[model samples]
Target: MTNLLLLALSAAAAVAPADNGGAPQQGLLPSSPWNVDYAEAECRLSRTFGAGADGYTLRIIRGANLKGVQYVVAGQSLKIRDWNHSGTLGLRPGERAYKLMVAWYRLPTGESAFQLLADDALRPDEIASTRGLVMEFDGAEPLVFAVGNLEKPLAALASCYDDLLTGWGIDPADIRNLKTAPDPLDLHTWHLYDDAWIGKAEKGKIWMSVRLDVSETGKAVGCHTLSPSGSAEVDTKVCVLSVKNARFKPAISTAGDKVKAPFILKIQIREQPATR
Candidate 1:
C-alpha cells in the first residue's frame, strides 16, 4: 500500500501541468476505448490498459449525488494486503492532481482491487475536455492511459445521474447551478453508524442505496432506503442511525443560498472484526 508521504512526493515529481494537448506517453500504456454503463443505481465508466501480467481495468463510478466519485482498479497486477492505501489521480490536460485514500475490495472474479472514493467530482466540462489519466500507487509503477474522447459518454452518465435523482422525486431542473450537494458538517458524527448494524447477522457485507430529505436547516428530516440490504433489521438500523446523525450542509445554489434537496448515497455495511 502507498503511504501519504510517498503519494505527495510522487505527485510533485511526476504529475505535470495538463492541457488540451495530449499527455506525453511517459511509458503510458495503451488502453481500450472507454465504456459507459447505466447500472441499477450508478453510472460507470471503465477501460483497460497494459498487457499480460501488467494488465489492469480501471473503473469510475458515480452514484445519485454530485460527489463521491469512486475510482476502482482490478486485475492480478496489484495485491491487497491492507484495507487502505494512498493513491493519486491526474488528468490529461488537467493542471492539478488529486490524492486519495485507496480501500481494498475483492471482486466477483476473485481479483483484488483498490478503490479510491473522491470527495469531489470534476465538472462535466473537465471530463469532456480530457484525453487521458495517470494513476500511481506506492509499491507498483504508475499506470497512464490514453482514455479517448469522453464527451458523449460523460453526457450520457450525467443523464443517468439525473434519472437517479428523479427516482428520488427530485426534478433535474431544480438542481441547476448547484454549488454543493449535502455533506456531513461533522464527519465523526456522520460515521458513527454510517454502516448498518450486522453484529448479530451473517458475516458478509450488506450494500444499500439510501436517500435523505435534507431540510433547509440541513437537518435530516427523512431517511429512506431505496435498495434492500437483504435483511429487514439491517435496513431499519441504517435509516434510524442515518437520520439521527444527519446534520449536514444543505445543498447550496450558485448564488450561495441553501436549498432543501434530497441527497443519495450508496453504503456498504460489514460486520466489524472483533479486536483483541
Candidate 2:
C-alpha cells in the first residue's frame, strides 16, 4: 500500500498542467462518469477507483450539517473493535493539504471501512477538478485515489444536491436536525432464521451490533460488527445478513429533506428448545 501511494503521487507530480494558452483552462469534461442512486430521500453518487476487484468504492452521502465520502475496500478480515484517528488529504498532487478525520469499521470476512471528512461539504467543482487524492491514515500506508474525468458525473451530482436543497429551502452549506430517526433493521425480512445458523444454535443468546452506512434508498452499502460475538460465524453472519436483509425508514432532515446517515443495528438471537 505504501509503495503504491508513493508511486502514484510521484506520477501525479510529474504531469504538467495543460496549456490552454491563458488562465490554464483545464478543459474538464461536461459530464461525469459516476453512477447515482436515490433512496430514503437522499442521493448517493458512487464510483470505483483502481483496477481489478481489489480497488475501493467511493460513496458520497449528504447529511444535515455534514456531507462526506467513504472509502470502502472489500474482503478485509481485520477484527479490531473500533478505531478513531486523524489524517491528511492531499488533493491535486502538490496542492494545499486538508485535515480530515479517519473513522473505520472492521466487519466480518475481509471487509474494511474508512471515511474522510472535510471541515465542510465540498462543492461539485472542487471534487471534480481534483486530479488525485492521497489519504494518509496515521501510522498506516496511505491510499491514493484517482479522480480524473469526473466533470459530467460531478456536475450531475451537484445539480441533484442543489435541487434537493432548494426544494427544502435551505442553504447549500447550512445544517439541520433530523426530523425523525431512521427505521430499525428488521432481521426476519431476510429470513435469517432459515439459515444454517439457527440449526447450530445452542441454549445461549447471541447479541451483536452492526454499524451500517445506509444509503438514500434505505439500502446498506456497508455493514461492520461493532463488537465481536464469541462466535465468529455469528458475528459474520449477522453483519452479512443484515446488509442484505435489514431495512431502515431512511433519515429525514428538519427541513423535510431526506438524507443518508450512519445507523447502528442491534441484534439478539436467542435459541429455544425443540418442543415435541
Candidate 3:
C-alpha cells in the first residue's frame, strides 16, 4: 500500500519508451551495452485483497513484448490473451487486482537476456487509462518494459475497496488473520534510493537503483547517513528508517558543538519480508 516505488521514481527521472501503444524497442537508445551481469537476478510482487470465501489470485510476466511470454489463467491451458498487444483485454468487474510475478533466467549465451522479465495482473483503471504499465529494470542492462492485461475491471474494483479502507482508516477485524499464500516460483523487483542532505540550505538530490530478488521474510537492515554541505560539521547520530513504509526520518541532535549547519541524512531501507 505504501508508494515506495513512486518515491524512487520522483528521484530518478530517467526516460523509457511510452507505456501506451508503442512498438517493441530495445534498451536505452544510444547507450552502451549493460555491463552488469545478472546471472543471479530475481524479482517478486504481491498485493493484498479483501478477505472473503473466494480469495483472489494474480500473476504477472515481463518480456520484450507481450507476445513473448506464455501464460494461462485459473488453469494450465496456454492462453494468449495478448493483453499487451490487444491494448484492452484482461479485466473483470467487481474483482480485485491480482499481483504480478516475474523471474530472470540464465540464457545459454553468457550475456543475459533482459527480456521476458515480468508478468502481473492489470487494474481496470490502468487499462482504461494509460497505454500500459512501464517497469524500470536496473542492472548491467537496465531497461524499461510495458505490461497490459484485460483484467482491469477486477483490479479497479479491488482498488476501490482499498481506497475505501484507506480513506476511512478502518482497521479490518481480520487484519491479524491474513496470511501469505504459497508461491512455487517467486520473482519480484525492489527499488532502493540513496538520500542525503547536501547542506542546511539545500537538500541534495536522491540517487536510486533497483534489485530483483526472491520473495522472503526478514528484518529490515541498512546504513543511514547525513552529509554536511559546504563547511558545516555533520552529526548523523539520529537517523531512522521507517519499517512500516521504508521511509527515512532524521533525528535532531543536541550535541551543540558537533552540530552541522548544512547536512542531510542518508537513509537506506534494507529488504524485508513482505506482509499485510
lDDT of each: 0.68, 0.53, 0.25
TM-score of each: 0.74, 0.45, 0.19
Cα distance off (Å), candidate 3, residue 69: 11
Model 3 local distance difference test score: 0.25
Model 1: per-residue lDDT, tens digit, 1-276?
A: 353233323432343433334334432344577677777677787777665445678778877655568888777645664734788887766565789878876775666677877876776777877786777666554556566676776776677777876776778776666778887677566663533365633446555677888888999888887776767787777678778886887888888999887777667666333321
Model 1 residue 269 distance off true place after TM-score fit, in angstroms: 3.0
Runs in model 1 deviating more than 4 A are 1-33, 81-85, 93-95, 138-140, 185-205, 271-276
RMSD of each: 5.9, 12.7, 20.9
User: Backbone clashes per model, in order?
Assistant: 3, 12, 35
Per-residue lDDT tens digits for candidate 3, residues 176-249, read: 12222112121111122333433322333222111111112322233222222222222222222212223211
| Candidate numbers, best TM-score first, in rank order | 1, 2, 3
Which candidate ranks first by TM-score, i.e. highest?
Answer: 1
